[model samples]
Structures are given as structure tokens and as C-alpha cells.
Target: MIWLALILLAPLGAGLAIFASRRAPGALALAGAVVGLVGALGLFAGATGGATVSASLPFLPGFPILLIANPLTATLALLVAGVAAAVLTYALGYMAHDPERVRFFGTMAMFVAAMELLVLAGDWITLLAAWEMIGFASYLLIGFWHRRAGVAGAAMRAFLYTRSADLGLYLAVFVLIGAAGTSEISATLVTTGTPALIAGLLLLVAAMGKSAQVPMQDWLMRAMAGPTPVSALLHSATLVAAGAILMIRAAPMLPPGALLAVGIVGGITTLIAGMMALAERDLKRLLAASTASQYGLMLVALGAGAPVAALLHLIAHAAIKSSLFLGAGIFQHDRDSTALEDLAGAGRARRGIFAGFAVSALALAGLPPMAAWFSKDAILAAALASPAAPWLMPLALLGSLLSGAYMGRALRALWSGTDSQAREPVPFMAAGMGALVAAAVVLGAGFGPLEAMLGAVADPKSWIVPAMGLAVGLGGLALGWSLAPARLLGPLLTPARNGFAIAGGMDALVARPALALAGTCERLEAWLFAAVLSLGRAGLATGEAVRRTDREAIDAAIFALVERIFLMGGRVRRLQSGLIHRELALAVFGIALVIGVLLAAPLYR
Candidate 1:
């Protein structure tokens, strides 16, 4: 419980502290990240193999702010902590020369905290809240270079697009609460069918937005406007992966048709984005597209009812892609360019960075003996077991081929020339890349342990599947290498380059109109408020008139009666004189007068 709280709060606390301080925010951020890293490892050790520890807060009634360390959460939490630690370590060197190190470090800390909470959340409300917080953090990080219009625009675009999908998640929560009377994941999963199906579908839409699926994917490409570490964090282990995790968590409740739909979308995104990566001239853009394509592949595994396979691919992709991005960043920092053409002889100059890049790229292409190769094959095998196996297998293979083709293109650009003047990479950055590369190797070598972990949840038929996947991955890579660049299919390249234009079009058409409609509603609300105020003023005037009329009538009558009573009392007092006989006569006369007045006033009249 203490470790979990530290993991969630360390970043947030550090962020606040850094912002409050006037100097060395980066140092403060790094220190906080170190603490978080330790806490994460502690939590992992304390709750290995799905052990859970929970505590309730006294303040939040009924909610408790629970944190569970199930296998899934544990795995994701480790990933978040690991990446954040690596990135923060890298930032120690990367931001040393930057002017806005304070803002950068502070925002990074906040982002880490949000991501940790997202993985730790046990209920849908907590998950959604953390999800939005991460989105907020991304918005700040993406636009870190606020001086650049493109960076700011990209950040806004990402925020708007994801928020639109978040609405679907919100609706899903409502549906679940209405149908199951609880937002707890366990409860919702237990109440499957009908409304649950609808909830699943809505959740898929939210996943699509976050994962950078066809219609909501363009923001990722534009997101390259941010700094490289931001890119690595967003593309590799954090933002895009969150959507896949959400779907995986809800797998038990998802309908077959909905799952199939998820598979179909994933398959299409993989194919399209892979093609785009092949045509991309910018190295970072290529990587961005590749991230989308890879995420789509993971989604395919999830949709095919193979959560373990999806998780395997996710872990492999995270490690390899982080290294690749860091390598790309090193190149860009040296050359001040992300264009692939500008990096003609980068490989010979930066041998270590290029070597790291190549290893990761091969892993991404699912080459043999690499972590991705085994994991990807497992997904294909899972798909084969599904009813849509025939179609899914072909699509997965095609995506693999495209991934190989683009990766080959990148490799050729990096290694083909022999320029000696290319710059060397920073030590800390290389260390970060090296760490991820080592992780990839370890994951690949220890496939047995990973397989065992996954097998506990599902079957482990490893031999044939791994062999076939390796063969296909290697075959694709060889085919891509042997073929001449000019002979590559042109029309397919165009579609890939454009990423089906789905993400861009959706942004311009759907998201823009929705934002416009929101603006219109704001105007309408202002008009309504004015109208209500005018009506209120008119009602107040009418109320004042009614009050005045009542006051005039009631007060005038009371004053008139008081004057008459005073005159009558004076006439009665005049009868009560000085002498005793006179006083007796006056009293008798007063009594007679009162009797006469009472008789004459009513009965006589």
C-alpha cells in the first residue's frame, strides 16, 4: 500500500515541488522519478503473479481510492515506471542545455503520475479520471515548445481528437452503471450481454482514438512536432498502449461481433500505417506510423481473444520502439534534421546507435530469436483459432511484409553511405537506448519464462507457431531487401503514405464541426442567460408594484383608524374631571356615552 501510494504520488508531488521552486526543476523531477522507480520495483516484488493489496481512504466515502496489483496492472505499472525512469534519466542529459528545463521536467513528472494512476485504477471512474489526466499531461508535453505554432497546433489536435473519444468512454461508464449498478471492472465483466455489448462497443471507440486507429490516427504523425523524449514516451510505452490495455482488461465482456470489429479495425490500421511508413520521407514520421501499425497488431491479438499474445507484443514493441526513437532522436539532434534523405551515411558514423536501431528494427519486423517474432506469431496462431482466422492471418502476414519493407528502407538510408563527419550521440541517450536494447534481448532469450506466465492463463503450444512466424518474418525481410526500391508498388505506397487519410479527414471534418457546435452551444447559453435575466428584472418590477399597492391600502386604513381612536379617547377623557362628585358624574356620563356609541354605531344604524 505504501509503495503504491508512492508510485502514484511521487510524480505529482515532485511536479508541484518543482513548479514551486525557482530552479533545478529537472533535478527535482529526476529525483522523484528515482523514488518512483524504487517504489515500482517494490510493488512488483510485493505482488508478483496477481497478488493484490488494497487500502481505502477515509476522506472519499464509498470509493476508497483502491489500487490493485493484479497481473495485468502489475505488468502495465512496471512498464510505466520503467519507461518514465529511463526517459527521466535520458532527460538529465537531454534537457541539460534547454532553456525550459523546469517546465519540461515538471510536466514529465505530472505525466508519469497520471499514467501510473491510469494503470492502478480499479474502477472505471478512477480509470477515466486518470485517463483524462494523462491526456492533459500529453497536451502540455506535446506543446512544450510553445513558441512553435506547429507544436502547439499538434498538441491541440491531439487533445481535441482524444477528448472526443473520451466522451464515448464516459457514456460507456453510464451504461455500465445503469446495467450493472457498478463501475467496478469485475462487476461489469460479470454482467455481460445486451447493454454490456453496447458498452464494449463504446469502449472500443475510445480505444480507437487513443490507439491511433484509422480515423483518429493522424494526431500521432503531427505529434512528432514535440521533442524526441516526448515522442518516445507517447508513441512507445504510454499513450498509445493505454487503449490496448483498456480493451484487454474488458476482453471477458466484449461480444464476439465487437471483438471481430476490433480485429478488423486493427488489421486495416496495421496494413495502412505500415504502407505509410514505407513512403514516409521523415524518419520520425516513419517511426510514428510504425508505432500506430504495431499498436494495431496488438489490438488484433486482443480482438482475437489472446490477451497474453497482445501483452507479449505490447512489451516487445515498447522496448524495441523506445530504443528506435531514442536512436532517431540522437540522429536528429546531431544533424538538426529528421529527413531520411539527410541521414544517408549515419550508420557508419554512429555505429553503436545504428546497431541499436537495427536490432530493434529487426525485432519490430518480427525477425527470428527476437521477442516480437515469438509474440507476433502467437497472435497469428490465436487468430487462426478464431472464426475469422482465414482473413486475419492473411492481413497479419501482409502487415508484417509492409513492416519489413519500410524498416528495410530506413536501414538502407542509414547505412548506404560512408560519411565520416556525422556527429556522435550523447552518452546518457545512448545509455537509455542500450538499456532498452538489452531488455529486448533478455525478453527474446527468456521467452520460456514469459510463455510460462502467459500459459497460466491460456494454452502454450509454442513449437510450430514460433517456427512459422520466424519463417514468415525472415522471408518478408529478405524479400524487401532483394527487391529494387523503384519496383516497390507505387499506388499502395501512396495510400500508406497518407495513412488512408482517415485521421486527417476526421480531424478536419468530424472534430472541427463538433468543436464548432460546442461554440454555438456556448453562444446559445449566453443568449438564454440574458433572456432569463431580462425576465427576472420584469418579474421583480411586478413584485415591487404588488408590494406597494398592499402597503398603501393597509397602512392608509390603519392610520385613519388610529386618528379616529385618538379623538374618541380625548372625548372620553374630558368626562373624568377634578371634584369627587364631578368625577362620579363624569364616569357615569363616560359609561353612558360608550353604551350609546356601541348601540348607535351598529344596532341603531
Candidate 2:
């Protein structure tokens, strides 16, 4: 538990330190990452050693924010830490020449810390808090170089898209916690029937946005406007990974109805995104598309009731994808552009970097002995064995086929250029890429132990499963290397590349409608303001009438009475000025008048 806190705090504290002191920001960031990496390993070791680590801090009344070290949480935490360390290490070299390294490193650390909080969260309360944290942190990181035109807009697009989808997460958590009577995530798995199904579908909606599945996939490509390390971390195990991780963690609670829905969504996303990868022009955007496609495959695995397989692929893909992005970053640095035409022959310019890049690319293509090869096979086998095999299997194979094709296309484009200018190697950048590439190459065989640790043993559908996957991958590679992606995809290329839009996706469907809704709301607010102003004017008019009534009618009547009183007083004063004899005479006259009146009254009666 302490280790988990360290894992969460190390990056966060380091980020704050960088922002506060702005001194040796790189060294501070590196130290924090290393400490965080060590702390994550410690939690992993402690979990496997049966340490029973758990902590509950007061968060909500009767709903504590829980953080615990179980096989699942610990393993996920390790994946996050590993990827963060690698990405940050590379960023040190990548941003070495920048003046705002302090700000950059600070935001980067904050981003990592947010993910750690997410991965280690034990209850819905903690998860949701961490979830928002990661979203906010990603926004800052994505727009870190905000001076660049369109870069800040890209960040805002991502934030808005995900923020809108995050409503689903809140709703799902509300359902689960209400039904289960607890915020504990594992406890909520006991919630069955309609509520569980409802929660699962809602969770899938959130995952789709975060993972960049289908309709939500557009933002991931646009996100390339951010710094390269941000891209690497975002795609690997932080922002993009959050969606798949959520689904994986919630897998046990999903019902058949929801599961089938998940399968369909995943299948559609993989096909759409894989084709987009094949058609992408920008290297980073291409990799971004590939990330979505790969995660689609993970969703396919989870939907097929194989979260373990999904997780394996996720871990392998983290190392593989981040390494690939780092290589692209180096290529971009050398060529000053990530456009395929500009990046042509970039591999030859930095042979060592390309070597690592090729290894990861081959791994990403599902080549033998690479981490993704094993993970991909597991997914294929799981799909073949599942009830939805008929629907999922074809999609899985198609996704795999396209994965290889796009990867091969990238390789061929990079290696085929005629220019052969060479430059001295960047040892710092190379070291980071090398570590991840090595992991990508060897992490496959390591999955057996990981599976055992989690007790999620693999059950391939005979030896033929892996063989079939390998054949499909190789065939895609051949097709990609020999033919243009447009020719290979034929008619489907344009739509898929354009993100499967109906006349243009987000612009036509989502953005315009959202803006229209906002406009309507604005008009409504304006009318409301005018109505309020009209009411105020009417009240003022009424008050003015009341004031006039008091001043003209009431004041006139009072003044007239006052004038009469003054005249009467003047008469009395004149009487008082007379002698006492006059006063006596007046009193006698008054008494005589009273007696006369009494006598007249009697006569009248």
C-alpha cells in the first residue's frame, strides 16, 4: 500500500517540484520516474508474495476511496509504470534542446501520475477521480506546445470528445454502486441481470471514446499535433489504454447481451481503424490508427470472454507501440516532418534507430518471437473458441491482416528511399528505444508466467490457430510491400481512410449538431435575459405610478387639510388675543347655543 502511494506520488511530486523550482527539471523527472518504476515493481512483488496490501482513505461518506494490490491492479500498475519510465527517459533526450523543458517535464510527470492513480484505484470513487485526472493531465500535455497553431485545438477536441463520453462512466458507476450497495469494484461484480448489462454497455461507451474506437477514432489521429512523447505515452498505457483497461476490469460483470454488444463494437472498430492505418499519410497518425486497431482487437478479445488475452496483448502492445513511436520521433527529428514522403529513407539515415524500429514493427505485424505475436495468437485462438466466432473470427483475422499490411507499408516506405545521409546516433534516445524494443522482441515467451501469475491459462484451438494467424500476417505483409495501399484496399480505401464518415464523420454528424444545440441554448438564454429585463422595466413602471399617486393625490389632500388647519388656528389665535371678558362672553354664548339646540331637539321630537 505504501509502495502504491509512492508510485502515485513520485511522479506527481516530481511534477510539482519541476514547476516550483524549475531547476534541472530533466534530472528531477528522471529520478521520479525511476523511483516510480521501482515502486511499481515493489507493489508487484508484494502482491505476488501475498502481502495483502490495501488502503482506504476517506473520500465519500460511506464510500471510501480504496487502493489495493491484487494480481490485476498490481500488474496493470506495473505496465503503466514501465511505459511511463520508457517514455519519460526518451523525452529527456527528445526535449533536451527545448527552453520549456521544465514545463514540459512537469506536465509529463503529472500525466504519468494520473495514470498510476487510475491503474491502482480500487473503488469506483477512486477510479472516477483518477479518470478525470488523467483526462485533464492529457489535455495539458497535448497542448503543451500551445503556441503552434491547431495544436491547442487538437487538445480541445480530444478533451471535449472524451469528456462527453465520460458521462457514460459516471452513469455506469452509479448503476453498479446502487445495485451492489457498495463502491468496491470487485463487490459490484456480484450485481447481475439487467443492471449489470446496462452498466457493461455504458462502460463500453466510455471505453470507445478513450480507446478511439470507430466514431471516436478521429481524435486520436488529430492528437498527433502534440509532442511525440505525449503521443507515445498516450497510445501506449495512459489515455488510450484507459478505455481497454476499464473494459478488462469490468469483464466479469458484463452479461451476454452486453458482451455481444462489445464484440460487435470491437469488430467494427478494428476493421475501420486497420484500413485507416493502411491509408494514412502521416507516420504518427498512421501509428495512431494502428493503436486504435490494436485496441479494437483487445476489445474483441474481451468481448469473446477472454480478458486475460486482452490484457496480455495490452501489455505487449504497450512496449511495442511506444518503441515504434519513439523511432518515429527520431525519424521526425532527422527529417523535420512525419509525412511519409519526407520520412522516405529515414531508416537508412539512422540505422541503429531503424533496427529497433524494425524489430518493433515486425513484432507489431505479429512476426515470430515478438510479444505481439503471442498476444495476437491468443486473441485469435480465443475468438475461434468463443460462441461469437463466426462474427468475431473474420473481423479478428481482417484486423490482423491489415495490421501487418500497414506495418509493412511503413517499413517499405522507410527503407526504400534512395537518399542515404547518415548522422551520429543519439545515445540517450537510443537507450530508451532499445530497452522497449528488446521487451517487444522477448515479451512473448514471458506471457506464460504472466498468465500463470494471474491463473489465466491459455487454451489455443489446436496448434493450427497460431499457424493460421502467422499465415494471414505474412500474406498481408506481402500484399502491402508489393502493392499500393489504395490498390490493395481498392474501393474501401477512401471511406476507411476518411474514418468511415457519412459524407465526413465528425464535421457532418457530431460537430455541427453540437454547435447547433449550443446556438439554440444561446438563443434561449438571450430570450430569457430579455424577458427578465422586460419584467424589471414593468416593475419600475408600476413603482413610478405608485410614487406619482402618493405625490399628486395623497400629498394634495394632506396639504389642503394642513392649509385649513392653519386658517382655523389663525381664527383661534385672534380669539385668544381678545380680553378675558371676550373669552367669558364666548363661553356663555357656547352654553346658551347648546341649551337652545337641546330645546329645539325636544320640540322637533
Candidate 3:
């Protein structure tokens, strides 16, 4: 419990401190990462020793904020913390010259803190909050250079797309919580039948959005507008991983229909994204596409009902992909661009960095002795053994082939360019990338023990799976190295380069429609405003008429009558003047007139 608290607090505290002091930004971020890493290590150690630590603090009445250090979550915590530390270390050199280093490091630390909370969350409420935090933090980080061209748009696009999909998660959580009568994630997993199926599909929707699958994947390539370290952290173990992590955690609760949907989505994304990678002219965008493809393969494993296989691949990918990005970042620094054409011979100039890059690229291609090879094998095994083997196996194999092909193409491009003059030393950057690359190379050896630690059953070992993986991998690499992408992709090249936008992809499907709807709403609102204003004007006019009538007609008549009475009163007062003889004569005349009127009245009657 203390370790969990530290894991969440350390990075958060450091981030706040960086913002407050705005001094020694790199040092503060690194210290926070180190502390979080230590906490994760401690948590992992405890989990391995058969102890599961859980902390529940008051939140909602029934749904307390729960954090747990079970074997799986603990391992993920370690991964997140480790990756964060390495990326922050790399950024030390990457952003050394940037003026906003304080903002960058502070946001980075906060993002790490949010990711830690996400991985450790044991209940739906906590998970949802952490999920939102990371999304917002990623938005801040991705648009870190908001002044740059297209950076803000990319950040906004990423945010809007993911947020739209997050509705699925919200609905799924609602369904799960309602069905289970609790917000505890494990408790909700016990829910079965229609609720489970609905929740599963909804979860898949959310996963697709976050993990950059298919149509939702367009934003990811654009997201490369951010800093390289942002890419490294996001693509490797944090933001992009959130979707796959969600799926992996929820695998047990999915129905057959939902699982099939997941598999198909993954299969499509892997092939499509892999092609996008091959067609990419920019190195970072290629890597971004590759990240999507690899996560698709993880989805493939989950759909095959082998979440352990997905988990293993995820772990391996975190190291391999981050290492690849770090290497790319160094090259970008050297060339001042991420364009493959600009990066020609960048590897030759920095042979050491290039070596690390090559190793990780090959590892991603699933060659033996590398971490990804082992995990890829597990995924391939799962695919082969799945009930939908006919559908899934081919997709998995081709995805692997595409992985090798794109990586090979990237390597060839990097290696074939003219060597530039040696540049300045980047000791911090090199150290950070070196650690990840080493892990990428050697992390496979521990998979067996890791499986045992998680109590995950190892996939049945088979010669066919490895043999197939190697053949496709090698074949794809050879093809990419030998043939140009225009020749390889042929008719598909244009579509692939355009991200296979059938009918303008998301813009047509989501954005344009949304914009049109907004326009319609705006028009409707205008009409309503006009109508309301007209009604108000009519009311004012009616009130003015009533006032005019009261003043001219009714008031005029009353005033005229009052004036006549006043004149009569003045005449009557004059008659009461102190002339006695005149008064007596007037009285006698009045009496005679009254007598004559009475006599005439009686005769008429």
C-alpha cells in the first residue's frame, strides 16, 4: 500500500515541484521517475513473493478508489515506470536547447503519474479518472509546441477522436457496474450474459480508438508533431498502450461474438497499418504506423483467447519500440528532420546509434534471440490454435511479414544514405536508448519465468509456429531490402500512403458529418433566437398600445369629467356668496320652478 502511494505520489509531487520552481526541470523529472521506478520495483517484488497489496480509499459510497499490486498490474507498473524513466532521461539531451523545458518535464512527470494510476487502478471509478487524466496529459504533451504548424490540430484531433471513443468505455462501465452492483473491476468481470457481451463490444470500441486501430488510426501518424520523447513514451508503454491494456485486462469477460469482433478489428489494422508504415516517407510516421500494427497483433492474441501472449508481446514491444524511437530521435537531431530522405546515411554517421536502431528494428521483425521473437511466437501459436485459425492465422502471418518488410525497408533506407560528418556527443540520449535496446535484446530470456510468475499457462510449443514466423519474417525482410515499395505495394501503394481512406476515412465518416450537424444546430439555434426576439418585440408593442389607450381614451375622459365638476363647484361656491337679498330671490325662483315641475309630472303620469 505504501509502495502504491509512493508510485502515484512521487511523480505527481515532482511535477508540481517542477512547475513551482521552474528550475532544474530535467533533474526534478528524473528524480521523480527514479522514485516511481523504485516504488514499482518494490511492488513487483512483493507481488512475486506471493503478496498482493491493495489500498482502498473513500470515493463514491460503493465504489472506493482501489489500487492493487497484483502480479499483472505490478508488472505493468514496473514497465510504465521504467519506460518513463528512460524516456525522461533521453529527453534530457533531446530538449536541452528548448526554452520550455520546464513545462515539458513537468507535463511528462504528470503524464507518468497518471499512467501509474491507470495501471494500478483496481476499480472502474479510479480507472476512469486515471484514463481521463492520461488523455488530457497526452493532449498537453502532444501539443507541447503549440506554436508549430499543425501541432495544435494534431493534438486536438487525437483528443477528439479518443474522447469520442471513450463514450464506449463510459457506457461499458455503466453496464458493468449496473450488472454487478459494484464498481470493482474484478467484481464486474463476474457479470455474464447480455451485459457482458454488450460491455465487451463497447470495450473493443474504446480500445480501437485508443490503440489506433483502422479508421481511428489516422490521428496517430499526425500525432508525431510532438516531441520525440513524447512519441517514445506514448507509443511504447503509456497512452497508445492503454487500449490494448484495457482489452487484455477484460479478455476473460468477453463473449465469443465480441472476441471475433476484436480479432477482425486487430487483423485489419495490422495489415493496413503495416502497409501504411511501408509507404511512409517520414521515419517517425513509419514508426507510428508500426506501433499500431504491433498493437493490432496484441489484439489478435487477445481475440485468440491468449491474453498472456498479448501481455508478453506488449512487454517486449514497450522496450523495442521505445528503443527504436530513441534511435530515430538521435538521427532527427543529427539531420534536423524525420524525413527518410533527410535521414539518408544518418546511421553511417552515428554507427553506434544506428546499431541500436538496427537491433531493435530486427527485434521488431521477430527474428530469434530478440524479445519480440518470443512474444511473436506466442501470438502466432495462439492464432494457429484458435478456432478461427483459417481467418486469424493468415492475418497474423501476413502482419508479421509486413512488420519485417517495413522494418527492413526503414533499415535499408537508413543504411544506404551518404554518411555525414560526426556530430556532438549525446551521452544522455545514448545511455537512455542503450538501456532499452539492451532490454529489447535480452528480455526474451525471462519470459518463461514471467509466465510462471503470473501463473499463465504457456502456449503449447510447436515447431510449425516458429518455422512459419521465421520464414515470413525473413522473406519479408528480403523483399523489402531488395524491392522498392512502389513495386512491392504496387496497386496498393497509393491507398496505403493515403491511409486507405475509403471515402475520406474519419473526416468523411466522423468529422465532416459532425461539422455538418453542428452547422445544422447552429441554424436551428439562430431560428430559435429570432423567434424568441420577435415574440419579445411583439409583447413590447402590445404593452405600448395598452398604455396609449389608457392615457388617451380612459384617462382623457376621466380628466374632462373632473374638469367639468370643478367648474360646477366654482359656480356653486359663487352662489353661496354673502349677498342675502340676491340669495333669497334665487331661492324663491328655484322653489317655484320645482313646484311647476312636480305639477307637470303628476299631469303626465
Native-referenced Cα lDDT, model 1:
0.81
What's every prediction's RMSD, in angstroms?
8.6, 6.0, 5.1
lDDT (10s digit) by residue, model 3, range 475-520:
8898888888999999999999999998889878776777688789
Candidates 2 and 3: which is better by lDDT? 3
**Ranking of predictions according to lDDT:** 3, 2, 1
What Cα-based lDDT does every candidate model obtain? 0.81, 0.89, 0.93
* Candidate 2: tens digits of C-alpha lDDT, residues 1-605: 67977898999999999999999898888788889999999998977765657888897788998987888889898998888888888988999999999988998888888888888888998999999999998998888889999998788778877887899999999999999999999899888999999999999999998999978889898899988999999999999999999999999999988888888788888989999999988899999999999999999999899999999999999999999999999999998999998898998878888889988988988989889889999999988988999999999999999888998899888998876787766777888888899989888887898888887866746778889889988988888888898798899988877778776676555556666888899999999999999999999999999999999999999999999999999988998866899999999999999999998997887
Least accurate 10 contiguous residues by lDDT in model 2: 506-515
| Model 1, span 1-605: residue lDDT tens | 88888888888899999889847887788788878888888877765565677654433455445567666677778888887777777777777799888889999999989988888888877888889988998999989997986888788888888888888798888898788876666777876778877888899899988989877878888889888889888887788888988888888788888889889889988887877777788999999988888888887887788878888888888888888888898888777889998988887789888999999889888887788887788788888787888767777777877788778788888887877775744888888888888777668665556556445455656687676677767766676666643467656666656667744587676668877888899999999999999999999999998888778877778988999999999998876666799988868999999999988888655
Which pairs of residues have clashing backbones in candidate 2?
A: none
Top of the candidates by lDDT: 3
Q: By the TM-score metric, which is better: model 1 or model 3? A: 3
For each candidate, give its TM-score against the true structure. Answer: 0.83, 0.86, 0.87
lDDT score for residue 510 of model 2: 59
Least lDDT summed over 10 consecutive residues: which range in candidate 1?
55-64
List clashing residue pairs in candidate 3.
345-417
Total clashing pairs for each candidate: 3, 0, 1
